[model samples]
Target chain A: MIARVVVVPRPQVADPQGITVARALAQLGFAEVRSVRVGKYLELELDGPPQDADRRIEEMCRKLLANPVIEDYHFSLEEATTQR
Target chain B: MIARVVVVPRPQVADPQGITVARALAQLGFAEVRSVRVGKYLELELDGPPQDADRRIEEMCRKLLANPVIEDYHFSLEEATTQR
Candidate 1:
């Protein structure tokens, strides 16, 4: 199964990187640019059948895949429904 | 509008960070773990109405948001149809 995880930082946390990028964009003449927050995206190929992929992946995220205090993460698992 | 961008490294690119994490997980007893690829995730709160959100974000991804040479990205926009 292919697990695609997207981790987003909480709104209140200080996003220095995002702010830096925003400033750079403005300097580059992208006047319309407003805000930017950066996070992590992970793609994992798990060895598992489809029947338990979602539950297993969710557990993995809650455990080691995400930092709950500062980030929120969600994942989609694919290529298991038809596997026999 | 909320723009969430997930940037993933091309499969051919070396993912040292992911490999390190995977090895750490194994040492920590996550024996089920196999392979890992790390990427980037970004969330942007745009100062615009929803009408043009999709088109605008896609353009952003193709331009300054993602590095097409080594990464792939996708995003979704929200809270526009109900805006009055």
Candidate 2:
């Protein structure tokens, strides 16, 4: 199975990287751009039954992939179609 | 308008960060995890007509959000429901 995970800073948290990117865009003349937020996208290939995968992925996110105090994470799973 | 952009390293590119994450997961007992790839997710808030937004976003991606030599980027636009 393939797990697609996204980890993003909580809305209330300040994101310096996002602020920098927004400023850069403005300087580059993309004046319409008002704000930006940056996050992490991860794709994990796993060899496991569907039933166990969900639980394992959740555990992985909490323990490693996401900083629960300041970030939020979500993921979805799909069957792998090709070998890696 | 809001644009959600995803930027990922090309498949042939080396991803040491992903390798480290995979190794950490393995050590932490997530042995089913076969491989991992890490990428970036960005959300941009824009103030513009829907018609012009797509072209501008494409230009932004080509000029800034993605590295043409090592990364691939794609984005989707949506109506903003709330102010940032």
Candidate 3:
């Protein structure tokens, strides 16, 4: 299966990276950019049924894919046909 | 308006970051993890109609959000309800 994961910092967390980019954009004259928050997009292939991938992905995120202390993660699984 | 942008490295580009994570996941015994590709997700707000946001977003990607030589970007815009 092909799994796509998105991990974003919680709203309450201080996003220094985002702030830095915002400042840069402001300096560059992109006034239309009101605000920005950065996150991670990950695509991976796993060997499992859709249900199994979902259950295991949750554990993977909690244990390794994301830092639950400050970030939240979600994923979707699709059948993969391309050879690895 | 709220815009969501996803930027990914070209498939031909070497993604050291993704490879590094894949190796770590393997070491951690998640053998089901076949491969990984890492990218960036950005959420930002702009003051404009959805169509305006789309046009400006394309310019932003060309000028800042992504490097055409190695990355590609796509975005979606939606009406934002909450105050900035």
User: Candidate 2 DockQ category?
Assistant: high
Candidate 2 lDDT by residue in tens digits, A1-84: 999998989999999999999999999999999999999999999997889999999999999999999999999999999866
**By descending lDDT, how would the candidates be arranged?**
2, 3, 1
Residue A46 in model 1: shift from native, Å? 0.5
Error of 3 at B65 (Å): 1.1
lDDT of 2 at B13: 99
lDDT, candidate 1, A1-84, per-residue tens = 777888877888888989987786677655555788888888776674568778777777777878899988888877734333
Tens digit of per-residue lDDT, candidate 2, span B12-61: 99999999999999999999999999999999999979899999999999
What is candidate 3's lDDT per residue for B1-84, written digit by digit as tens? 988888888999999988988888888878888888999988887875566777778878888888999997788888898876
> How close to the true structure is residue B62 of candidate 3, measured as C-alpha lDDT?
89
Across B13-80, the per-residue lDDT of candidate 1 in tens digits comes to 88899998778667766555678899888777666556777877777777777788987777776652
Q: Arrange candidates, best TM-score first.
A: 2, 3, 1
**Clash pairs of candidate 2?**
none
Candidate 3 off by > 4 Å: A81-84
Candidate numbers sorted by DockQ from highest down: 2, 3, 1
Where's the lowest-lDDT run of ten residues in candidate 2 chain A? A75-84
lDDT of 3: 0.85
Worst 10 residues of 2 chain B by lDDT: B75-84
Local lDDT at B73 for model 3: 77
